[model samples]
Target: MSENLGTMTDFSPDDSVMLKDVLRGLALPQKNIPSLYFYDQRGSELFDAITELPEYYPTRTEIGILERHGAEMAAALGPGVRLIELGSGSALKTELLLGRLEDPAAYVPVEISREHLLAAAARIAADFPDLEVMPVTADFTEPFDLPEPARRRVERNVAFFPGSTIGNFPRGMAADLLAATCREVGAGGAMLIGVDLVKDRATLERAYNDAAGVTAQFNLNLLVRLNRELGADFDVAAFRHQAVWDEDAARIEMRLVSTRAQRVQVAGRPFEFAAGEVLVTEYSHKYTPAVFRSLAEGAGFRVARTWTDPEGLFSVQLLEVPGAAQDSSGGT
Candidate 1:
């Protein structure tokens, strides 16, 4: 096993996988391992840079909308609320919301990275001396309950799920995750969600596949991460980054394509990759307005109001949980 030493700035390609099960799953005849694993410290930093690219409109556009309408959203929801955020990255755009919120009692940031969660929470605590910071490290996709500390706040809860994190989930999983959040916070709570809108293919494609090749490195770095953490032997030059538009599915697929046939041993097991084998990393599903609303309603949320950028490139929707109805018949 060769030890690859370099950062994403030097990211090449490889055929490694995360856990043993993950490697087996990816090597399956037909299966797509998740890309969320790509979000190591370096990968996260690269993503932050990706957001700053001029071609990436979602981050800036969403921030702009928040800056203009954050106070309005706070006022619409009332004051002294507990703000819970899911998948809080750097929380860069969220300062716009945090600064404008109606004197939140506590700010809870949920993240998968322990280092990031603690760092972001510490910064927020120092910045907002008046507000309390509660950081939880857990995967938000599954039906896992919020932490004990999080559940203590029985007051009016307001979730700040910024970034296009919801898009990371497929339609079914998205609805389930939203519903789970609603259930956790209970009725009279609020969920402020950021969603990317469907747009022209060229613009969308450019955002993920940047000219500086940063996005490519970010995608390919997943293998690097696996190799470093797991005992795996993977040739970093055997694969390439692939970003394709799946118009039929209305989503963008980011995959790591095998440049040539290669055999890799990971997690105490050996696996083979065909010359054209692809590891489907991530699928960012775009949403139409009507579709999002229908999803929220289906998940026991009342669409209160939404803020969209001038060009309609992105949206921030505030949903009231079970406003006046919860027993209404819908999907399970």
Candidate 2:
């Protein structure tokens, strides 16, 4: 392993912002919480565990596609390109791409977890001795500054956003995120994103509501996080995890349903919950090929190419600036 030290910054979750969002969301008519809050250090670890579950097909399917075609994706990107990944959790799958890219300028990973970001960056630095590992910790949803080191060494930047995380955003927010990413990488830069394809409702439901109850534990961990961080009094045992496929919304909605009528206090604010009342935890939208392509075009990116497993349960799409060279690799 190389002793190269990668630079890392701490732009973690803002305490005040989190408090405001939590209170505001709890006050809503439907009572919801932003999925972003699900990623404190513990939540991040639980998510990592969720990715490895046998029922969680997105992670494995995306990795399989990349394992088979990461080289082709890098080839389409050409040489001397800076690779920046958004919400780069663990960055485990990225090694496949980094191994194939020819003379890449740098590897900039943008993440929200400071600890996780630093650890992943250090591992990447050791693994790729010659590659510049500049890890940034920031909420990728917002516009943030990149360190001088990144701006100085980057050439043509390629933003890699895998893991079907885009599904977390609704149509409008997803568009805004893509626009922000476009600005980060500049007009002539490119993007490679993983999207979960609209599949059978049973499959989608099973993926979120796993049999081992690990998913349930992961969902409940949010309460544990709130109790510790925000001084919230949540009876973890009083709530149960529920994942349902919303056909009308074309998304999987995860909620923590109150087992009984109860009152909870968070940071001195009291809230009442009725029996069976639920707090909306997450929304993961599935998309068809046409829908995703349209979204990319609207966000100012052209679909350069797409790769998918034989079953088409997921898709890894290479999107580029309009004038960028089209990759003859097409689809697989």
Candidate 3:
């Protein structure tokens, strides 16, 4: 563990870039906002709360898979591997993998929020004192360099992308991001990812539109973020959170619909909204094993193994590059 916990590779997007992205999205006819912006300190906290809700089954279910079969997942990766986790919020599930790994080289947690990333890295460092904890403050969806660990001889780099965060991107973008991750981890490396399986429409809809309304708050916080950071005057109360399962798209679309006709100014620019108009916030796509295997293969990875709960609500898959040896572990 590094004594200077504050030290990290910082490639975080600047405010000017964020303003540009927001403006560009607003200019589109569909009116969308990039989901990456939903991880400011407050938004991150809200999301942590969301995972605890009864309706949000992905987190707990994935954690259960990790707890039950994490050793096998680690064994499939072999030893002295440098673990890189994308969108590693709190990293509660990662501890299981780390504890089971044999003499791991280092742990790199890439996240968008600096505060949350650092706090989680500090805790991991304290608990795994012998392991190197390197935190990177950047959007994992984009290209960024991984910091080299000083103390260990790394055998390989394995990316841990959990919580079905990959579902946020459309199919094309998700494939591209996986390709980029493949490049980051190099030829012989692998990726251990959590993927949400396609299930009943009712259960999927309930997961996003929770009874506690925390998911609603999580969706609305994006506007609050824009208001505070970009000097936007958005009547947060004038909009209502909505989550609709788009059957054709096989995704849950999260949006903010205007309650009434209104105009909002962001970064000194005006945007109009009709009473029933919606501004898309995020999309969560579900996949079956075959569909996900195609998606992974398109990104240059071979599905080595997959572990799922008995109910098959979620899966934690190990995907390896061609140079790595394939494990014969069967999927549940």
Best by lDDT: 3
* Global fold similarity of model 2 (TM-score): 0.94
Q: Which one wins on TM-score?
A: 3
RMSD over all Cα atoms, model 3 = 4.0
**lDDT of each residue in 125-159, candidate 1, tens digit only:** 77776666656665555434442222233356777
Backbone clash total for model 3 is 0
Ranking by TM-score: 3, 2, 1
Candidate 1 regions with alpha-carbon error over 4 angstroms: 1-21, 143-154, 324-332
Whole-model lDDT for model 1 versus the true structure?
Answer: 0.74
lDDT of 2 by residue, 1-332 (tens): 34455557556668788888888889888888888877777778888999999999999999999999988998998887777888987999999999999888778788887878787888899888878787888888876666543323445778899999999998899998887676566657889999999989999999999999988988888888888889999999999999999988889999999999999998999999999998998999999999999998888888989999999999999988765433211100
Which residue pairs clash within candidate 1? 13-236
lDDT of model 1 at position 65:
88
Ranking by lDDT: 3, 2, 1
Q: Relative to the true structure, how large is the alpha-carbon lDDT of every model? A: 0.74, 0.84, 0.90
**Once model 3 is optimally superposed onto the true structure by TM-score, how far is the C-alpha of residue 15 displaced, in angstroms?**
0.4
